[model samples]
Target chain A: MTRTSDRERRRDPARIALYVFLLASAAFFLLPVVVVVLNSLKTMDEIRQGSLLALPASPTFDFWRIAWSSACSGIECRGISPGLFNSIKIAVPAVFLSVLVGALNGYALSQWKRPAADRIMLAITFGLFVPYQCMMYPTIVLARTGGLFGTYPGIVLIHVVYGIPYTTLLFRNFYAGLPDELTKAARIEGASFLQTFGHVMLPLSVNMLVVVGVLQFTGIWNDYFLGFIFAGNENAPMTVQLNNLVNNTRGEVAINVNMAATILTALPTLLVYLLSGRYFVRGIAAGAVKG
Target chain B: MTRSKAPARGLSDMPESGFRPDLVAIGFFLVVALVFYGSLLWTGYLSLTNSRLIPSYEIVGFDQFARLVATPRWRTACVNLVILGAFGIAGSLALGTLLAILLDRDVRAEGLLRSIFLHPLALSLVITGLAWRWLLDPVTGIQSVLRGLGWSSFHLDWLADPDTAIYALVVASIWRSSGLVMIIMLAGLRGVDTDIWKAIRLEGIPLWRAYAQIVLPSLKLTIASCIILLMADVVRSYDLVIALTKGGPGFSTDLPAKFAVDHFFGRANIGLASAASVVILGFVASLLVPYLLIQRKGRA
Candidate 1:
């Protein structure tokens, strides 16, 4: 770190060029968001007259209100509000179940040395690599046979099932980082598996819960395909609604309203990124490094 | 707490006092194994059948596979997958590595720039698609914007043209994913040995050569991981295609995952869809096996 700062102290042409390149690239990376936000606040007439880079003639929040309350998505014109609630309804339980299950799996894998445990873990991790499309057909059939197709619980269960592999990998790696002596001492003290896990492992996993919660909530909340396919029209999540709002061409294309809806749908994950991006990166790194 | 004095029982023995916690993990794994793996095997079995809208129990051998091979739309979708995967992975790797190097130079507003670059990853692909679609539209998009600025002859209609629509997917995907690669590469760069830098400087070696010859060789794992991750995204790329083109412009931008979905839900060809899905899983697994092997070797 000091090396970088010391180099920065030197006034070199290379350093200046590096800064220029970074600034330009940063603009490039941020261009889409800037365009959406700028145009979203402008009237259609103003947008037509000006380029995407143009500033709004008169900024307004009307589009935001309309997108939230009354944008047309197919025959239903109730806007993204219901979808927002549905997403929350799905994400809350899906995140809770997936994370809780993952934490338990991690504790058990770390504490108990069951026969074929490694192979079972390997199979679960391999499941992570299998494309969701591969499982779509049978999953749909299973949901139908069990009478869960196009239901709220079906979508939630899909998220939980899919999320288990990732969450299990995360918490397992997290628990593996702790000293095994803690478990050994707990066992030696006559603590049964459940007792050791509750008293020792669960308390130690508090921070891991935050990591898992943030990951699962953001993923499930932003998910579109599963919701579109399995959650049914009534329970379609915000992402599906956003797609409907943006891509549905039956009505007049209101660029402003569409952009506002896009931002609204993306807001939850964006906030999580802004707030806990470091942990997000850590979670990804854990999966990548341990894979 | 007073039970500390008692002899420890068998590790697998049930607890006499409280709830059985082992049941939580064991049961969850059991169900996931049944659901996830069982689903894969079931899909494979379905692919061999003559199922249409509804699944059939009678086997049709490789007839569905033969149909998949002969279908022009399926072939186009497979070709598009390769195009998206090749260009998307290469573009992200190059751009991300460059961004990482630039950030490593201790530029001003480092934190702010990093956040700006990384924020795209936080967004869902649906938003990325919508945002880019508007920006790339011919009439109200960048082309018009450029024409409005006196470049009246500017022509940028990739999204609408059949030949260029798949490229549009490539662009949006790279934009959405490059930030992840940048962050990962930056982390890898940070782990470089300081002594190596000092040695290179003492020998008056140029910075680029030092990185090319010494530093990058050590970051092989990071590079491989980036490629593997990007390939996985390519195989699972359904949302971006759906929100962008919906496999339109005469099925020019059709991808395997999107094809599977359209067949399953829209076209009602369960057998063909299942076969396409198995092909995607096979592609992804081919890439992942080496990654898993490398990880195991690293631990050993």
Candidate 2:
């Protein structure tokens, strides 16, 4: 019994140490966002010469307003709001289409078996590694050939194509874990191919749908390289606005506005994550374990 | 409830009477594969020819490859990639693991903490880069702040200094990457069997010891995968470099991706870009092969 209390005493310090170390570590991770948020409140003059940890002298919101409205992204000075809207337009449709198609493909692949199934799956697996850069020129060539270049549909198509591999992988794993009997029962009830997918497979896939949505949402939304190269200057996304904001800002740097623009560019995904952290985490866990 | 509904289910042992057309699915797969793969093949072919602006029939026979290999900036990019890969992966893993461990202890508002750690993963490098530029600007950022706090002699101009720009890029990148590692590590943590903790309690094993010896080793696959993803990010990091520095401070922090982009579009040197891309692809493929083998082993 004496030994047991001694062990208890030992465990006591260990738990305390764990808590201490972990809290300190959490603080470290929180620093950057804290810095970004704080910086957004100060003026350029204040930010340029102020301590990183210190609150703004007047705690103004001018930088936030300017970064959202009047900031230059290259030669234009429309701020990052235009790009934010483009991201929304690109993201909403891309998510719905990609996720819908992905669910269908995953359901079919997981439920059906044939020589072609493996071949299709293998082709997509390889697609994941093809590296978009290699495909960029040809996509352009194909786009121009097809008279689709510099168009909204053309860029959305690119997102959908690239989005398939990740989304398919997500839904495939999810459907694999679903009960085969549900599908079997539906077929016995005279359910057609489309009906089985719509009523049986998709209904049970809410968790995975959330997973696919968040991934695609973050991906198509935050995408910079593809959007830069393909979306054209007219349809450039939020990143492009932020890029313009960063690139064209001349000397005597406007640090406050820059920080605010950065914040604005990241706001949508940040807002979504804020609202749906659980769904995102749940989706990730589902995808990772299955992946 | 499901068991009760089971018998009401209309399922049958007999297979469906007709073959599903599945043509739409098949066509979708074929079309995407052809386009994506066809482009890659074209890139490979283009890399081998003496072409500029468009595909050409003139065969260069590795001249572009030879020129690419001989270029100092290209060599520097290769070296820089390795350094960024190692440091960025290592740094993020360490920082993320620490955050994961901290957040695992039933922290108050664990959800909020987790979100904070993950916010960076969803953000584009364009914004993150711009933000960091503001934070790191020598005349206007923290340096000036420090100097204003009256350390007039302090020198913190790494972003401006050619000697240290790559490292500065690594620092901003770590901020972008470590959150992913944290989330991944947290998932790995949740998978740790409760019985292991029971065993540790029975044996009176130190928490740190159990974590280091057992938990850390168990996370080898997670760590490896995180490393590979971070490495890939560093390798393919073009936008971040473009937004952050634009290969500036005298092109000190140039990367292969940026080099490829500049040659392909900016400089209109398609042959050089293709050659450079082919090299980068080869390196990526090699790294991936071993990593895949490791993953396959873990599967077994």
RMSD of each: 3.6, 4.2
Candidate 2 lDDT by residue in tens digits, A81-178: 88878888888998999999889887776655555675677567555655677567777888989877877888888898887877777776677677
Model 1 residue B134 CA deviation in Å: 0.7
**TM-score for every candidate vs. truth?**
0.94, 0.90
**What DockQ does every candidate get?**
0.53, 0.41
Runs off by more than 4 Å, candidate 2 = A1-24, A249-253, A286-290, B1-22, B106-108, B147-155
Q: Considering every candidate listed, which one attains the maximal DockQ?
A: 1
Lowest summed lDDT across 10 adjacent residues in model 1 chain A is found at: A1-10
Clashing pairs in 1: none
lDDT for residue A263 in candidate 2, whole number 0-100: 77
Indicate which candidate wins on TM-score: 1
lDDT of 1 by residue, B148-253 (tens): 8899999989989999999888889889888888888888999999998888888999889987888878898888888888888889998888888888798999
Docking quality of model 2: it rates as acceptable
